[model samples]
Target: MKKVLTACLLFVSSLTFAQQTVQRSAKLPNSDITETFSVLRSDKKIKQGEYTATAGNNTTLAQGTYLNGERAGIWSFYNISGKLIQTYNYTDNQLTFADSTDTKGLQYVMAGVKTDDDVTVPVKIGGSYSFRPTFLSKVLTQAINKDFGPVANATFIHTFSLNSKGEVTNHQVKVCINGQNKLYQVDDSELDHDLTRFAPAMVNNNPIPCKVITTNTVAMSNGNLPDYANSTYLGQ
Candidate 1:
């Protein structure tokens, strides 16, 4: 019986490790051209490594790394000309801090709308809150409790707008635990308090209004990582 149990355990372990890494490509939404991009994944979750994105012209649009499904280290972004436009740091997928000394670091992720010849578009700026891996790891490993646990996969979406100065305002947030809605219609002031750390977006050497959206997902079960890959542009 002991040998049989050991064999069963090995079979499960093999299945877990057999979970293959994946790569997916798609076109960005609302783009004028067929601008395509791709991302690498492991165990269905985005892996920690270097990635390059290309535009419709096959020009490099961005290059960066993902650490445990979050952008970590430094990411370099480029324009249509392939010129380096922005380089930024991410901690736990949060652009919480920037070093002034490093001029290469981006102050904000640009959010803009295209305008037609007759119509004008508005400029907005924003950012969101994310969980640190250390904190999240605890939550994942801990037993579920009524007061302080999800014990299963969950996702939270926070949206907001920013002024030219990079301050968060006019926001809405929703939290879902294991596919169940827990909180929605949170106050803007309450959400703004946590967004004070985000850097502002800039355009043509001037700060501009930007819209920010952040999605946080926690994968609690095996092979559950792929579902979180819907949006490759996190914290942007």
Candidate 2:
């Protein structure tokens, strides 16, 4: 019985390690970069195992492991000078390190619809609130409870923002109370959940502070409140 179990374990291990995958290489279209990676033998499209992209000058642009089809494990991004710029762990969903000073990486991961890398803004780890990994809901709930009172059928314009350091800053809210426009500053600290760990926005593989501007309509959250002067509207 012991021998049978051991044989089965080894068989499974062999299947996992020596599977139907082949190493392949491809030159990027219109680019001097070549990518060496593994793909499924049956379908040449599904990437598996270790993957690397190199420039024409023999510089490693990007290297990471891909499990089946998605990016897995820790991926290290290098600057143009081949300097280690950042390491992001997809399994743990965290950024290990980021060098904000290095503006030129051997490679760059440009994302979003913006072509101007200099003005690209920072983004939260989670693309949306539902996918966010921070305690944003808790923080926002606290702010609404303190400033807006409670959740009702009313809605308010709440700008839940964070600083370049990925910390909860002075988020604001705009609401009309008693026919007067009021703006309240909700000061909250990110002692528990910080945004930096999510590998925030980087320009040319350089980690820098960026602000995410979002117009959030918090409905059924901010309730009745006292009237305030027009100047109190976040000083306009």
The 10 consecutive residues of candidate 1 with the worst lDDT sum are 125-134
- Cα distance off (Å), candidate 2, residue 181: 42
C-alpha RMSD in Å of predicted model 1 compared with the true structure: 18.5
Q: How many clashes show up per model?
A: 6, 5
Task: For each candidate in the order shown, give its overall lDDT on alpha carbons.
Answer: 0.43, 0.51
Model number with the top lDDT: 2
Please write out the lDDT profile of model 2 over residues 115-180, one tens digit for every residue: 656643343332221112221234444543565464333234445444445544545656543344
Count of backbone collisions within predicted model 2: 5
lDDT per residue as tens, model 1, 137-221:
2222232234335444556565556776656655554556655565344333322232243455545555577755656555554
Query: After superposition on all CA atoms, what RMSD does each candidate show versus the true structure?
Result: 18.5, 17.5
Q: Best candidate, TM-score-wise?
A: 2
**lDDT of candidate 1 vs native?**
0.43
TM-score of each: 0.34, 0.41
* Candidate 2 backbone collisions, by pair: 79-105, 79-106, 80-104, 80-105, 80-106
Error of 2 at 19 (Å): 4.0
